[model samples]
Target: MSLLNNVFYFQNGIGVLANVFLLLFYIFIILCHRPKPMDLISCQLTFSHTVMLLTGGVVWVTDIFESLHVDNDIKCKTSFYINRVMRGLSICITCLLSMFQAVTISPSTSFLANFKLKLKKNIIYAFFYICSLNLSLYSYLIFYVGGLTNVSETNQMKVTKSCSLLPTNYIIRALNLTVTTSIDIFLVGVMLVTSAYIVLILFRHQRQHKHLHSLSHPRSSPEKKATQTILLLVTFFVVMYWVDFIISSTAVLLWMYNPVIQSVQKFVLNVYPTVTPLVQISSDNRIIKILKNIRSKYHQIL
Candidate 1:
């Protein structure tokens, strides 16, 4: 294998493994443990990330579609479609998580407190709504992506070795970009607002604690830790999202993907999914406790 292929596969394997582990952990929480409000959202995010990473380029790179006699164009369209849907779901649910956490930490009399009950009740509905929204929003991909039959083609934007972006009407492409960018910006904006709200609440609580000299409350509340985790996640996601978005926009405009640029873009596109599970594992106390237990058990067995 080429060095590039090795690197891509390695990154994807790590991401897929981490995401699967995290997905199973969240499932266990729902079935065996009392799940939190944000647990459902986390489950959705992890599942989406897993699918996205898996579909990123594994089949095309492995020539599995050819071996199975699958049409190259169908593989291209399917992979791109699934990847985009999962990407959209990741951002949407991340925003939902942030908003839910903000509501969770709101004081009883605060305006956001009223939505807490409503959000938890409608969480499943929210999932369906986003699934439908993204499914519709990214439908243009099926039209604009196809198997690259000729490497000599100049106008096509090569996304992977097997498929490239086909040309479409200028107006349609422009509208799609506008709508996609608007949706992404709106979601990121909501995350930022919620993050600021959480930070403000944390600051106020700190002041209140200092004023009261509450020696008994030395540890931060669970809500505080959860909000902090969400804030960190949102911040990292925004950075990765914008970087990927910029590269994607450039690809659309240029209508040609250079070899080096394509590799970089692929890496950038998948970075958020790869990093997300690691961040969750590090931040979540439950995962830490589980790891500790596993470690102690291993020692005992030894």
Candidate 2:
């Protein structure tokens, strides 16, 4: 087996395990939490991330098998479709998460303060709409290219009997990835900037002894903790995934000339979804509270 195959198997194994844990984590949140607006949204986001990882794992494993001369066309298409859809939905969920945090941290005196109440009930519907929109958008693109196939006995993308779509066809692919990456980067930037500004402004207001109604509340600890968690989440998202985005985009623009770079980039990109949920689990206080409550309840029952 080649180095690439070894890496692929190792990464897929990690994703499979991570997704299993994430699935269980989401179920625990759903069953244990009192269904706060953030809890429900986060539950969906965790579930989406798990599905995305599972789909990516399938793609990685299929690539390894194809490298070894075992090919399955149907699995290729299924993995391609599922991975694209789930990945797209995962991006949308992250956007929603940022927006959710932004609003949660927004001052009650702001014009958009009422938005918090309005959005509380619509999160599930919004997630469904985004998923449906992304599915339709990418499903249409899949028809333009031949799904995955065997590379050939030599195991080279160039030596394959299967052919790629013309460079003109690649325009849509490039455009789609560029636009998606741009949006993801932009939202992350906005989330970080806005969250930082909000926290700073709050600090300044407190320093000045300004009579902000929201900050006067005694329950400010949880609110501040949530804000800090969101900021950390945004930081982790940018740090971990930015390299993958750059590497993947560079590979596509180079037209896949560097197979070694491409393989490594794909591996990093696939691992990101798995890592993101883990970040959320460790960083979010609410999740920690739920876990502690679960442990306590289990002990009581025992």
Candidate 3:
């Protein structure tokens, strides 16, 4: 195995392990506590991240095996499509979470206040519809993505293999790209705008209460801290999403001129899935309390 492959293998393995930890931790929290809207959304996000990591990890492992002349086109294509779907679902869930936070913190007299009240009542239904929509939209992958085919045989006994889109029609390709790009752009734009609004609200509140004691100001509110965390999460997701988008777009435009581009794109795609759980846990009070309890018990035992 090449050094680069080894590095990716290690990275993916770590991601898988981290996601597993997050999944278990989230499940435990949900089971032990009264589930709030944010907690439920977080659980869904963690589940999506776990699936993304597992599917992507499988593809990476398959790549390593392929380097050793082991070919499994079916497994690779299946994992690839599943990973793509999970990635999209993760993005949508993150966007939803940001929107929820935005609504939660909306001013009582603001226009969104009534919508926020309605949204709280139907949050579960909203989540169900979001998951169903993403699943249905990404179902196109099953039709277009296929197993690897032998492209060429080199004189050195090396065989080149690739799993490519089945549709050769330019219209199909264009339609696919257009739909995917539109969805990504719309959701990302919502996340950015909503997060910006939340930040502006907090900033204005802080400024307005600058003379007040910390306890009296909304600046010290838990809602403000949660909003800040969600904003940070959204910011990180946007950065990673655009980086992956740029790399993938460049690779497509260049048409496989640089193999390194593909590797970088894969790495970039995994970044959010790997890091999101850590970020969520860091901002989660329940997780913090659980950890503190464990620490206390450990100290007493010691």
Candidate 4:
């Protein structure tokens, strides 16, 4: 019932709800409606976000697991492992989504256009690969510390906001950090590159549309709308991610733990997933049309 606890619960609750809503919506689309190209990927991203929120606060939410009489060490390890894995997936999947949208909007003359066929064919495989890789990479955390933390190590990471989650040799710590940061940088770099490509294509497309139709507000195609949404998502994610990454890297390297800084970092971590669904709900024409139809039907029944 502390202020930080309240904030954490609120943020995680909002994030979990938003992600679950989108998860169900995406599933409904895939099952009952004509699925959009982004549906499966978005669904996977939402599921990752939901699990991230639930597991990210394991230290604080341990009461839920305590019912099963799980040890505190086990709780911390579970949280650390899942949180890291989901964080990895979030970046990888966001990069993939941005790259796919770029390809979707690319002109036939563009080089990205050639990959469209192959990308669509292999998209599911890409998801599976990302999941398998993250699961394998972050699984080390659960065992890397040898079950319990070494409080004696000054370089122990204050993960799960309070748990000294990772304690190992400097060499191992450095190696893990290097590997994780390298993968994150590679994924984020992909997002940035594809986002820039998308923005340029959108600008050129808008100009062409205006020139052809001589209209002030040219209507956008569905592909253009989807591209814009993905761009916005990538931008929001990069901004949030860099904030969290800078703080986390600084803490992990320096072995510094400030309560307030960790709190802020936790908030930054949840912001992207919480806001993404709202953005998609508002921007997605299908969601809007569905809401409008439901409203009309309710009004008629009333």
Q: Give candidate 2's error at residue 85 in angstroms.
A: 2.0
lDDT against the true structure, per candidate, is 0.87, 0.64, 0.75, 0.81
Model 3: residue 87 alpha-carbon error in angstroms: 0.9
TM-score (all chains, Cα) for each model: 0.94, 0.73, 0.86, 0.90
Sorted on TM-score, best first, the list reads 1, 4, 3, 2
Better model by lDDT: candidate 2 vs candidate 4? 4
Error of 1 at 290 (Å): 1.7
Cα TM-score of candidate 4? 0.90
lDDT of 2 by residue, 88-168 (tens): 776666667777877777777876578988888788789789878877867753553343344343232321123332233
lDDT of 3 by residue, 152-250 (tens): 322111111355545345566567777888999999999989988998998888877776655586645567778888998899999999998887655
Which segments of model 3 are wrong by more than 4 Å? 59-73, 153-162, 213-215
Name the candidate that leads on TM-score.
1
Worst 10 residues of 1 by lDDT: 215-224
Query: Residue 41, candidate 4: how far off, in angstroms?
Result: 0.8
Candidate with the larger lDDT of 3 and 4: 4
Winning model by lDDT = 1
Q: How many backbone clashes does candidate 3 have?
A: 0
Which run of 10 residues does model 3 get worst, by summed lDDT?
151-160
Listed per candidate, the RMSD to the true structure in angstroms reads 2.0, 5.3, 4.1, 2.6
